[model samples]
Target: MTRTLSRAACIGGGVIGGGWIARFLLDGTDVAVHDPHPDARRIIGEVLDNARRARARLISAPPVPEGRLSFHDDIAGAVEGAEYIQESVPERLDLKHEVFAAIEAAAAPGALIGSSTSGFKPSELREGATHPERIFVAHPFNPVYLVPLVELVGSGPQDEAILDRAADILARTGMHPLKIRREIDAHIADRLLEAVWRESLWLVKDDIATTQEIDDAIRFGFGLRWAQMGLFETYRIAGGEAGMKHFIDQFGPALKWPWTKLMDVPEMTEELSAKIAAQSDAQSGQHTIRELERIRDDNLIGILHALRANGWGAGETLRAMEERAFAQAHARAAHAAPDPAAPLELHRAKVGGDWLDYNGHMTEFRYLQVFGDATDAFLGHIGMDADYRAQGLSVYTVETHIRHLAETGAGANLTVRTTLLGFDAKRIRLHHEMVDGAGTVQATAEHMLMHVDTQAGRACPMGAPLTERLAALAPGQSALPAPDHAGRPIRDIGWPLGEPA
Candidate 1:
């Protein structure tokens, strides 16, 4: 199993399959998709579009160049020479068996085949297959492009190395692959989800709550808690410092109190189906499915970003991936020298829809965030890297003045340029310009940074390495005139206070 997977085959192009394609492609793996659905291309395109937008907003580090995507009408054509193959056809066992048989015939001997089946066990999916060892369930949550969790189930005499290879491949695509210890009907997460889902259905069947109400109860309450910390850990906190044992002792009795109808399932009669459908429609029918998807992606991005900031759960995964991306970008840039004629163009990003305000323009705080990232890049380029900070020496921003020159909207591509204005041992002044794709300035920022001995909590002289690099950049940038917006006083007007009146 190579760390660098070049090509992958997707055997379906519905929601889950498209997500697999989007995740693979975004992570720089070329994808070949095979699907017989007439609307496969259109559905996958929509998913990819949402994926691209969400990914841009979710991570700030330089993205890997997206891999080429090609659609194939036949499974053999798609799976040929593919290092990895993911099957996401309908949930029917016979259909999956047919698809797996076709894939096994054409797929390379070493290629790992993963099925996106939520309900079927890996043993069942591998039944009657030539290479059952290579066939396993790699179940993923909906909108798989954004969610990081992928359940990996492998329970056969097949090569153990093959299972490890599958995990490696999924990790490379920015997923947290949880290996199932044993084969189960639905595998861990879905089983837990099914229990809750059954309860929610019972509530609707009893007319105690509508679909939206059930959703609201989850999203507004435990869902937020679950996102960051799972059930047991959350309950551990509920023990009031006594710990899990105490909490379980207190709440364990309630488990048998018949609070939930976990053993019972509501019959999906026509009346119940129509009731659920009508309620769902009335709750969310204002938006089309595509619109709802965008909304979901946007909300997920916000939640993930917050988690990333805190380095919790899925956020931890995202942060790790971002650090890897940043390091890779820096490594690539290290091979090339910065051009003296141009300001260092190291940071690039697209304005996310979440950054917009009521006026439909990028808000103020994001401007500073972009500038800060550019500054960090400049620091990394000048030998002020993680090791430098780890040694208790770093530069801290002391002052900043930002000037908004032009309005930029969501999805606008942005490029940042960092100019060394002035520098000495103790402090450095920098000017950053945020420009759009057309090379028009959207905003400008002037920052003064103080070199600090972080442990001492005071300003300190920078090391010779950083000083030398700054000296090199300063001379070239000094030849250019000071920006007109620099050093402008914060005032209502430049003239005398009463002159206009």
Candidate 2:
């Protein structure tokens, strides 16, 4: 069996290190960080804040319990007893070598050590290390907490088992780990990005375009396409059903054209540096870094959500993780059994900013959405899980009546409690109450669900096992008085008083 990572040590608390910290902590792994810089704590704190906000928006299911975080003044103390150690020191070979030595001295004997160096090959990073086989490169993208891709590379006489363990941990943390076949100066993605960066710098130095315009060219065009489909796939579509070979043949000669400055390097003189900085400032200097980060996060959330709906690219990753999370939550609920006196509290969510209406409260339709999620939870509890549904029998909502009792604004934490109102062989009635943190009723939904054989496309009786489970709950709920607003017509409030004119 593979060892499960529960605690990790971060050697540097800079941007990349902080991102690693956020990703680990959010995945329920305790983190110990070490950085000699005076402002390390503040920087890491800010990054964690941004990560938490983005995570709340990205994942709709309840998250795992957050892990504890501690800061250390020295690398030895940070890596003490840590099962995994990550070094994110400045991208200098000597600095990384020194940090890795210290980490190897302090971390557990078999601990997997990863370096966040974007350019250095793993062989260079493990040059003077005692445990070179344990060292690998786990380069991650900026905003490591959100971006899923991580490039994993191992150096000289690599231990395949160690790399497999590292990849497993990364995957569990909601990251896609691409194992590099051989050592390279800059791993796959960055090499491609560096090429683009080199060309963009030449464009800026030659005064052909400003920073903003270059960004616009990408964002408004291929960037959106690349979000879900990569360069080859996008161009394949452009081939108009002929496929990638056709695209290559059609545009193959253009590759030789001097459209890009790939080989030539731009001199970054003080004049050019100042010009670039000023132009960048002019382009986006109005917002503070935090504000810009929020804007970026919002845009990413929208894009990821759209992709998730289509189940493509990064969206596909998000959807798979969410299903695993929901299944884990369901399993935990089953083990702890619901309290008979109170409605089963199985689902909780924070109102996301996108859920708010123009009036600044949660929209009406979202009430039904929350209730629907809660009902799904109830279905899972009574054995109507994904596996059960796969047998071609499942429950489907036939009718829903929602009553909005109070308004709740964005960021308000809401809990859903579901009560079984009644059930027969073919139908089950459920009442769901949505309450704020203070237990105030924010909304209520009464739903009727029909058990159906999806293959037959008609109502059907639930399995004997599920029926027995519901029968146990029906009696306890039967003793309770009916809700005051259980049955109400959708009509004018004063219809009887006004009468027909």
Question: Which candidate should be chosen as best, given lDDT against the real structure?
Answer: 1
Model 2 misplaced regions, further than 4 Å: 1-4, 156-158, 383-393, 453-459, 464-468, 489-501
**Model 1 error, position 382 (Å):** 4.7
How would you encode candidate 2's per-residue C-alpha lDDT over 57-140 as one tens digit per residue? Answer: 888766767889999988999999898888899988988888888888788897889989899998888798897889999999
Q: How many residue pairs clash in each candidate at the backbone level?
A: 0, 0
Q: Per-residue alpha-carbon lDDT of model 1 for 1-501, expressed as tens digits? A: 237789999999899999999999998889999999999998899899999988888888777789999999899999999999999999999999999999999999989999999999988998999978889889998899999999988885453677788888788777898988788899999899999999999999999999999999999999989989999899999998789999999999998798998887899999999999999999999999999998998899889989998988899888877876676565555444778556878788788778999999999999998898888777777877666778899999999999898989987999998888888879989899999999999999999999999999999999967887777777778887888777776766535665652
RMSD in Å for all candidates: 3.6, 2.8
TM-score for all models, in order of appearance: 0.86, 0.92
Clashing pairs in 1: none
Clashing pairs for predicted structure model 2, backbone only = none
